[model samples]
Target: MEQRHKDLLRENRVFLIDNLIMKNFIDHVAELLTANMEDTIMSNATNHEQVGCFLNILERRGKGAYQKFIEALTDAECDHVRSHLEQLEDEDCVDGYDDIDGPIRQETGNDDVDLHVSDWMKTDLSEEQRQTPISERAMAFVAREAVGVMEVGKLMGFTEGRLRQFQASSPIPSSQISTMFSAWRSQKGKQATVENFVRLMRDAEVDEQHLKNVITREYPPGDAMA
Candidate 1:
């Protein structure tokens, strides 16, 4: 009788440990799916492929365990999971479901540069928008508007010839322009106004005079010009 009692206790302990492990595994999978869902949805892409890959990994790791894990959840919990997945799928459709292009930008009349930058930063940009090189005209306009070309050139460590070349070139590689912008921003004490103008010029269409006026108003003759 004592031997039988010992055996039953051992069995109970094993069952408890197994239950604990299964609960942990299920929680981990849920967390992963939730994170993937958020990332995919926010970036305006479907998570089907990622979710499928995750499930495949779970199945490969332990098919029986995966099945048991699914069975362990209550019907309501399962429904909740399915609902979230379906909602994300629907959102992807509404978001245009293009990973390469991202969500389409809706044109709005509000051209307030600060507000524009704030809104623009909230969404993912298209590949072309991110990859396309900055035109020299655009760079020149930004420099001429925000800070003088001489100051930009000095901050960017450009030689006189290089500065002249940059002014003359039509499209400078985007990477170089990014470096210049970073340098300019750092030198300007990380001013949001300067950062906003650079981001606006790089990401959106703007009139030269309008941008110039915005910058001129923010930094009068002696402030940034000096």
Candidate 2:
């Protein structure tokens, strides 16, 4: 089996059985598959091969088949799923995770200054929130605050020019950025630099909570999604 399939099995084993919310998500996916298959048999059949790869992993876990999987769900399980789904849906609506309908915050403005490090530290933001992409201004600030763009890029195993391109056009992966940050900070007598870097990130509106979490070596909640 593919590593991705193995990972799915591992995640499903950990989350899907005991977690009603996950179970409901799987059920919803199954429902969507059924509906799509009803509409276009051949298309859905092709898709089913991909899904079948996932289901086969579950079957290996002693679930037998999809119908049996549905039959196995208890009333209490269904109730818990519905309750959790409703709560999540409500939160999603308020947060606009699906569709953010607002003006993008400018790089240098009062809006940028609004999200202070102290305010972020007080709230229990999820890993997803912390992992949100850093802005170019924030990346530039971090690069400046650290040893330098070239040094930081070397630490990240990327060329200085490539790192600059990433800062200008895209955010580096949070884990990679975090790892490089930590490694850069670990050099002897760099504690003050690290502190200054954190402040610079806060000033740049770079979601300093994640920087704090990384500097403190806090383990990600759950398995550090992506």
For model 1, what is the alpha-carbon lDDT of residue 159? 78
Candidate 1 lDDT, tens digit per residue, 16-102?
Answer: 233333322344444222233334433423234443333333322211332333344443255454344345545655655533223
Per TM-score, the best of the predicted structures is: 2
Q: TM-scores of the models, in the given order?
A: 0.21, 0.22
- Count the clashes in each prediction: 0, 0
lDDT of each: 0.38, 0.40
**Worst-scoring 10-residue span by lDDT in model 2:** 58-67
What lDDT score is found at residue 54 in candidate 2?
Answer: 36
For residue 223, model 2's alpha carbon misses the true position, in angstroms, by 27
Candidate 1, residue 62: how far the Cα is off, in Å: 61
Which residues of candidate 1, in runs, are more than 4 Å off? 1-125, 160-226
